[model samples]
Every structure is written in C-alpha cells, then in structure tokens.
Target: MASELPLPLLALLFLVILPPLCSSWRPADDDDASVSRSVFPMDGDVAWVVQVSDLHISAYSPERSADLELLGTALRAIRPHLLLVTGDITDAKNQQRTTSRQDEYEWVTYKKTIDAIVGRGGIDKSRIFDIRGNHDMYGVPYRGGKLDFFSTFSVNSQLKRLSTITSILLQGDRSYQFLGIDDTMSVGIRFPANLFGHPTDKRIEAVNSELQYLTNHSNAPVTKVVFGHFPMSFTASSEKGQRYESVFTRQSISAYLCGHLHAKVSKQLWRYHEMRTTEGHKSSFWEWELGDWKDSRLMRILAIDGGAVSFIDHTLNQALQTSILITYPTDSRSMNMLESEKWSMRNDINVLVFSHQVIRSVSARVFDSYSGFKVVEEIPLQLVFSSSADRPLFHAKWNAENYRSPSPTRYWLQVFVLDSHGVKISSEQRPFSVEGKMAIPTRSWLSYLVFEVQWEDMYRVLMWSNMAFTILLLFTPKILYHFVSRSSSYQRWVMSVLTSPIQQRKSYLWLVWFLMEGTRSKPFWSCLVIYVLWLIEMPWFWGRATSEDGEIAQMYLSGWSMPFHDGGLTGNKLSNPDVLVITLPFLYLVVIPVIVLIYGLFAEKAIVCSRRSRRVEYSAGSANTLAESARLLPDAPRALLMKFSGKMVSMVIQFWGSWTRRALLLACSITAAIHLKLCSKLMSAYGMVPVALSPPLTWMPLLLLGAAAYCTKLHGD
Candidate 1:
C-alpha cells in the first residue's frame, strides 16, 4: 500500500517547481532587444499569405477527393499572394490504416491535384510551397531516392529542393523573404519512430545563410518569415551546437508558421518564445500553428500590415461565401512591435474581405471592453477602388486623436458583412489597444498563452520525469517497508497521519496503498527490472532503418542522445531522446501502473477468500464438537444443537463484513478500465505500429497482470 504524504504539501511542491520548468529556459527578456532600424519595410501597408497543413491526401479514401476539390476551389476564391502547404501532402497508409508505408499512389494523387489546380489557372505554381510531414516520409530510406515520393512528385521538388527560399520584391524597393526548413529525419524510418523533426547541422547552417538577406543598401529592411513542418518543440537540436530557435531569434524572424498538430489544439497552439541572444540582445518570435486541412477543413490567412502581423483561421465549406481579416490598425494583441508601430498616426481601419459573390455592405463596430464590452460606435467601411474586385480591401477613416490613451485601456473590434445573395457573416471580436500598447488578453487569448506546452522544455521534462518515477518505483517500497515496520513514536505518528483515519474511509488512499503491497509480486518486480535495464543497457524498441547497402532492423535504446555521439555503436543505433522521451514514459508511467492495480485486485480478493474459508472451517469443527456433546447427554441434545447452529450462522455472516475492501477492489477495477480505454484511444489515434508492436510493451503488461491475478487464486490459505 502507498505510504501517506500530505496532499497539500505535494500540490504546493508541484506549484513551486512547475513554474520554473515552464518559464526558466527561454533566453530573451519580454521586451525584445530593439533593432537599430526597421526590419520590415513593405512597399504597401498589407501583404498576406495563406497557410494550410496536414492535408493527408489518400488514394484509397473517398474523403480526400472532397479535400482536393475544396483546395482547388479555395485557391481560386482566395487568390492569396502566397500559398504555403506546411506538410503531410499524402497519407502513407493502406485502406485499413493498420500498417504504414509510403504509397506512391497517394503522392500521385496529391501531385495530380496540384497540377490540376495550376492547369486551370487556380494559382501560379511559383507561389505554391510544400514541405514534408512525418507521414510523407514514412518508409523513406533516403531523400530523393526511389522511396522518396515527395522529391519526385511534390510541387516544391519540381521547382526547387527539399527546402525552399523565396523572395518577393513588391512594387517599391521593399521585399519579403520566406524560408522553408525541411527537418524531417534524413534516414526517414517507418512511422511511430519517425515522429520528431531532425535537422542536421549543415541544414541549420544553410538556414542561417538563407536568412542573411542583404540588399544593395545596408539599411534596407526585408520582412523575414520562416515556415516549417514541425513546431520548435517537436524539432530535435542539430549537431555542432546548431539550434533552430537560436537561428530564428538571432535573425530577427518576424514569425514562424507551422502545422503538424492538426485540430487537436486550437488557440493553445500559439506561443511566443522569448530569450536573450549570445550577443546579450533580447530577442523573441511568435510560433503560430495552424489546424489541419484534412478533417478540420482549416486554413489561415496571415497578413502583415505596416510590419504588424495579424491572422484569421477560416473553415471551408460549401455554404461559406466570404472570409474577412482586419489588417490595420493591427490587433493590439500583435507582439511583433519591435520593427514598427504606425497605428498612432494611421487614420484608417483596414480590412481584407474576399468573396465569390458581389458584396452588399460592410460595417465595423467598436466596444469598450473595460466598460463591460458596451458598444461605443459603428462606422460603415468603404471598399478601396484600387483593390481587386475579387479580393476587396475595405477601409474607413477614423480620428486617431479621439482614441489615444496613455494607459492600457482596452476595446473590442468586430467586422460584419452581408453579400449580394443575403449571406451574412461576422468576424470574432478582437481585443485591441488604441494607444499601440499591448491590450489585456481576453479569456481565449489568456488560455492559449498560459496552457500551450513549450516543446523546447518538453524533451528534458519527459526524460527526467521518467527517470525520477523509475527511481521511486525501484526504491520506494523498500524504504517504506523499513520505516513502516518500525515501532518508533515518529514512525507511528507518520503512519497515523498517512493512513489511519483516511484508510478507514472510502478514499483514493486505497488506490495508492493497493499498489504498495502489490509491488512485491513478480509482475511489478519484472517491470522494474526491465525498465532499469532498458534505461541502461537494453533497447526499448526494435525498428527498421535504411543504409546504402540495404534495409535492416535496428534496435533503439532509451536515454538521451541530443547532439548524437559520433562514430560508435551508440551513434549507429537510434537512441534519439525524442523517441525515448515519449515511449519510455508511456511504458513506465501508464502501462506499469495499470499492471500494479490489476495484480492487487486479484491478490486482495484471494486474501479475503482465504480468511473466510478458515473461519468456515473453524465453525464446522465447533459444530462437530457440539454434536458429540449432545449425543453424550441425551436430555439437552436439542438445545445444544440449536446453540451450535446459531453460532455457525453468525460466523458465516461476519466473514463477508468487509465492504470497505470490496469498495477498494471496485475502485481499482474502474481505474484500470479507464486506463486501458485511454491506452486503446491512444493506440487507435496514432495507429497500431508502436502501440501494438513486437517486444510487446502494451499487451505484455496485461498478460503478466492476468497471470499474477490467476496465480493468486491458486495459492491456498
């Protein structure tokens, strides 16, 4: 059983420790180091790019057809200045989705879709940029090889290399640079193994080179943006001290756009990573992740209006007629303020509204959020004549002097539009500050900022947490046994505080304690031994890898290998921290706990049954003695028999009296069931490879637990 620790103390410890875990590692101060001059000088006030990710186009699935048609239609309707397809251009799985492989047909389908769109004049081929997702690289032994369908069929491959760099020079001398980083593993192992983004040192150095944009003049500011398949958290650090985050920060990238997490998290995907550079200059960049285009039908329109970045995530559907994005005065929540803040002098509210049909009218509304979001004023916006009729840019003149504020007061802005066909749509209310000060983020923004996981910290946390938990499991029981058995006053007082009153009541203490005693069993000890061995000498998983010679099955071990050791067996094996950090924790934390609970359930039941059987045997023996006494004294025979019968009946009733133990058994069963269900969901969500793979981490726990449960019943009292 689990020894008692104060819940509040544990909670307090967690609260104290976790803040530093989340906050401490980033390098820069909140106020980024000021650049001597502007970095984003646009020919015009507005430049927008469309981003769509995780298409997962499949040849066998009927759903992909709809997605393809939608993509073509969207391209024609939106006609964005640039289109960035972040990754997962193909779903490399069979019809059952049970196995993963790089199917050429899926790539062919994706390629044909893009080719059709371009042929029909949907969008220019030069503007369309695509990159590789984990799914795209499934079973790819090497880049641009026979198995490399992406390099053969993808849009970027036809026009450029695996990674791309594009420079758009506008009407004036101003320009924008778009750098796409391809960090997918060079080896491109099978799925479940090929999860993290692995960028080589050469690739990272090349990225830095691409970012070093210099024009004829030294002061020329080219707005810089980077796009990649993986978020910084999912990306592994490169060899030779190269880091994607450091490069981006040092280069003063405007923003990093990515898409891999589909629609699992919405606003929570946004994060601003701040850190101080090696030069002691404060720097930071925003990581904006978009949802998938597969299931969510999602796409983002990212705009830079006078160097201030703003975006809107739009959902695609048949009835959806229009999309609206307010470019300037930019949303006050925009954090890229180091380069420009022209809102103070701007006299117009600029909005980009795209529609397939003729627009009837457009209007803007302002609300004072500090005054309980009461509507302050409404103004009609006039469509700019110079703007294209299809992608109409709407604006309305407003007096900036009236709304200027020295303090951080907040207001909400929303745009409403009605098309010629009577379809009405409105944009989500955006919180803004008129004085160019950062507005107080509303509930949605706060949730995103606070809850989004910082991936950079995640690798270390997962590795260390698994290590801590394993150490505890291996030693906690032995330590408790030593202290628990002792009869010192301190020990007694500690035991009373931990278990006495709480143990008497039906509480979660039962769940904890149930595993404590159960840890002595072979099933528990076996897992602990395996975990320790895996942490040190054993390989956690056996997966396939490719070399120039041929394909071979490779063993992957646990523990960290971030910079990757050179020229040894350790370097040759797949000991990536990214894979180990995830898989090791799952084995130790989730699978092992369920095993312990199930083992305890049957062990506890056998003990109770044994005690009941002993009491029955004792009662039977007393009844036989009473019968003998009654036979010897014939006069009181009946009375003696009646007394014996009553005593035996009472003993039987008393045997079943421990309802508290029954409750514990019931609680544990439910907990195990819930954990198993969660395991099932995860397995189904990620697919069957690693979840239900060989060496049997998932099913083996259940099997060993079942064996322990069965063996307990066979052992007699």
Candidate 2:
C-alpha cells in the first residue's frame, strides 16, 4: 500500500506529522531563579488575599444579606491584605430564575453591603477588586450608559474601568501583581442568552500591553496572579481570534482564579494548562474555580509565601471557630513547579490560623507514606506573631536540605491547632515533597480532565464537533441505504454485525440497530421537519438593537436574528464561534432529532409487541447456531434460509421487549421534556414565544412534546 501511494500524498502525510515530533520543549525560567532576592523569611514576607465570588445579593433572597454580614465578620477575623470579588456581585435575575433582567436596586444593595463591610473591617477600597460576569451585563446597551449599574456601583468602577492591574509590595521587597480581566460582552445582551465571556480585540491587546509593561519595569521577584469571572472553557475568543490563555502562559501567571459554576457543577474544577510557546519555551498555570458565595457562603484564602502560592477554599459562617492554612512547604501534587523554587529552599514550615479563641498550642505532625502513612515525627511549633485583627502565624524551623532524594518521595504533613477552651482543629493531611516534585499517583483522577485543554482550542472543537455530528446524523442513513445493494466488503461486514443473532446478543450493537431502524419511522420524519425549519432561520428572540459604536436607537430588533452572522437585526457583528451560537443550535436542532429517534424506537417496540401472540419466537442461542451452520453450508437448503430470516426478526423483537429498555425509553422521554423546557426558557429570554402560557414566552416546549407523544400513540395503535 505504501509503494502504490502517490508522491504528493506521501509528502502531505509527512507535512502533517513531522513538526510536533521534531520540536524541543523545556519549562519557562522562573523569576526567582533569574533575580537576586532576599532569602525566604519566617514571617512578614508572606501575604494573603481573600476571594469571594457570586454573592448574588438581591431583595428576593434574604439569606444573601446574612451572607454579606458573615463575610464582614470573616474579613475582620482574617484581615487579608486584599479582597477580590470575582463578579456576579448582584443576582441579575428576577425571583424566578427563568427571566433575565438588570435591577439597579440589587447593585445598590451590593454597594451598600460592601461599603459597610469595608468600614467595619478597615479594608481600603483601593485594595478591593471586582469584575463583571454574564449576570452582571444583562440588558445593558453600552459600557457607561445609565443602565450600566456595574459602572456606577462596582469597586473597580471607582477607578473608571473594572479591568485593572494592581501591585502590592510586601516586606522584604517581595511583590505580588494581580490582573483583573473584564471579558463581558460590549452590547450586554439579555441573559441567559448572553451566556459567554466575550472580549473585544482591543481588550485582549490591552491585557497584553499591561502585562508587558509590568514585566519590563518590575525587578523584584513577583508572584503574578490573574482574576476573572469566567473559566477558560466558558470564555469566547476575541474578535481578533485571541484567547486569554496565551497571554497568561507568556506572562508566567501563577494562577487564574475564577467562580461562575458553583458546587453542583463540580465540587472542584482545577485545570493545569501546560503550553509550549511558538519560541519553544514551555510555560504553565493553574485555573482554580471556587464555589459560589450565594448559597454555599464560600470564600478562598490565597497566600503567597516567598514566591510560592497556595490557596484554601472554606465556607464562612457566624460560629466558625478556627481555620488553618499551611503556607510554606506547599502540597506536592497541586503546586505548579514553574511558578517558584522557594518551596525547596525554605528552612521553616509556617501555618496561618484564623480563630476567635486564643490559640494555646500549635504543632506539626509528619507521616511517612511508604510506611502506610504512619506517624513518624511531631514537631512543636511556636506562636511567632499575633495581631488583634489579623490571623496568627505559627512557625517551626526545619532543614529542607535533609529530605532531598534521587526521586520523589511523599511525606504527609498536618497541622493541629488547640484553643484555650481545649477545642482542637486540624488541617487535612496533604502530601508534600522536599525535592519540589509532583505526587502523580496520589492526585485526583479528575485533575487529568483539565490537563492541556486551551480555551480557543476547546471552543473550535465544540463548534466543529456539533456541526460534524449533526451533518452525520442527518446524512448517514441516506448514504448507507444507497450503498447497501453494492458488493462492498465493508458494508457486508457491518450489515452482518447488525443483523446476526449472535452479534445482536451484545447490547450496544442492538442499540446501534435500534437507532438506525428508528430513522425510518414516522416520528423521526416529524422531528426532522421541525428541526430543518429551525435551521432555516435560527431566530432566537427580539430585543433592543444596538450598533457597534455604542449607538442605541430606539429602533427595535425584529425578524430572524442570526447571532453567528455579521448582518443581523441586533447590529452586532460576531464572526467566531461562541458558546451562545454553538449551544443554542445543539439544544434545538440536535436535541429534538435525538428525542424523536428514541420515541420512534418505543413506537416500533409497541407495534412489535402487539403481534407477539401471532408468531412463535426462537431462542437467540439456538437460532444463531443454526443460522451460522446454514451460512457455512450455503447449498444445504432454502427452508433453512427462510428459518434464519424469521429467527432474526424474532431476535430483534426480543431485543426491544426487555423491561430495562422500556424503562430507559421512558426515562429518556422525561429527560427530553426537561431539556426542552430549559431550551424554551432560554429562547423565550431572547423574545421567542413559548408553547402553552399566555404571552407565548414559556409554554411552546410542552405543546411540542404533547404533539410528539400524540403522534407516537397514533403510530402504536
């Protein structure tokens, strides 16, 4: 086969495969290694920042008021150097989660609560940073308009723009640089239609410019951190087709902190982005997604000890007694090695404890993982510093040079805290390495899910994958039917696998045949009609129209509006594939086809079961044996061939008759109903009418579902 290939074809193959194999990659150099800085200190050199996100304060929810008060209490207790609220400062939705509307009272409440907290806690307004999430941009026409409540009331609004760069210099000349990015859409379309982070080309270039300026002027060992509202996966590309990850990797960001998806989405979303730049230097960073503060009352404490960074997410409450965070000798499994070398060079193990009660005792417990994590040594730590407002610091001298090894070895460490009342609280035992190595085997399996997935790359994959899958689903059956009569080995093999009684014994093969058979049913055609009609226009909803230059003419948007196209009623130009365009098509066109196909399967099953009493069915095992024997001996008899065909029909009928399959069909219908309702609400937010209720904004899905169900029953009868 290789010898027969054309020269151009061979050359093209090598062109596609050679570059990645030939490239050399190495990790980007750390700032600490290049710059001369003071040796790691015991105290004062370390600083902590507090991050609280998705507060969603509103008049409808009373608990949010208490959450704000609890935050103030916690801030007074910990007294972090800086505070970061990473967007969705106000819940932009009504009491019902279905509609999206911006309320100024909500922003006013947020502003007042934050002002009270700042007054009570003595936190400088300049040290606090806030950015916008999707909820923050609902139904706004432009950036600084009267409806842009974020511009009027947000913390960063005091400085003119929400996106900002702020630097803090700790004792010993150690600097921490924080970059806040605002990637909310310019038009601020209504939600849940505006579900992605959209940054203009200028915004991306501005970020690049700011980071470049900081890198050029800064001489001290700086710990760079970026804060934003959206995770990399949820953010869309800029108009210039640039992503934030490229800037983060090039700038050597320590971590990108965010919170949009709360606890239910995933308990913890930790992504490690390792990239090789075009210049052949490898760089990496961590994207840490914290839980929401609305319901969970979550807050994150991020500490920078020397140049190393570590963080802990904790729930805030009125009665919480003690919270502990080990700053020095960071966790082996989670720390980014490229960020700092201080972890291996530090001579002391330091822990910060925030408590209301007087801390009477502090100790460090070490365990040997090779010996079944048995307790090996317990070092008594002393209270190094205690402030009336800030958290107390405890330290113990230890020689990191003594624990160096040829390869990585895990050493589990835990800190125990005892108050004056004899209440003991301990930190979770986390593995660490003196060699600054990773504990690969002990890491969570979910961490691998986040490895090496870039923002722009994932966006393209989602866009192309949806298009490819939809086209294949619609065209495959037609193509297969046309070629079924040809003498093709591949087709013959596939048909044999789909039809053979022995092969049909496998559940997955039967499922494949069931879906394949369903495309020929009447319900599938009914669904395809609606789906094709949806594709013809792709109209979502109607709303106020705005131009590219922030011009809002009371000219209302009408007719079919394609979000993907530059020419539209909305007057917004969007060329790249975003979550908004990609996800909406998938929910409407892609999902309905799948639901109808499943209903077709159940309808066919119903017809099969009605005729069960008329004909006797054969056992799959016995029938398969006879069928195989007849195929091997083709000249044996015609009666044997007829019996084989009948056996196949009976086997297929049995495949559809299982109680498990029936239950699954019913479950799929219920799931489809729920999915349809969700899509309906999303569409209605954009001006599309619903199926049942007056105003036509909330009932269309239920009506369509009823029609599908009625058609299924008619086909069955």
State the C-alpha lDDT per candidate. 0.62, 0.62
How far off is model 1, as Cα RMSD? 8.4
lDDT of 1 by residue, 1-717 (tens): 234334323433443354322222121111211111112233354677788899988877757645566656766766777788898888887677644678778887787888887765367787787888888877665566788888889887787544433333332244666677666765555545566776666666666765774433336456677888988767765544357888888887778998888775663376676678899887777888888877788878887766567888877755346888988766666543432333346677889887777888999998886689888889899887743444478889887666665544466789999998898889888766556666434446534532354444465576556555655654565355445545467434434434356447455444444445565454445554454444334443333333222233434333222123222112333325435434554655555565555545554664465456656786778778766767767667668675768676665545443453455456546645654664554344344354457344455555655555455543332
Candidate 2 residue lDDT tens string, 342-440 = 444667898989887889999998887778989877888887754433547789998777656544555788999999999999999987766677654
Please list the Cα RMSD from the true structure of every candidate, rounded to 1 decimal place. Answer: 8.4, 11.2
lDDT of 1 at 685: 36
TM-score, each model?
0.73, 0.69
Error of 2 at 436 (Å): 1.0
How does candidate 2 fare on TM-score? 0.69
Clashing pairs in 2: 541-686, 690-696, 690-700, 691-699, 691-700, 692-699
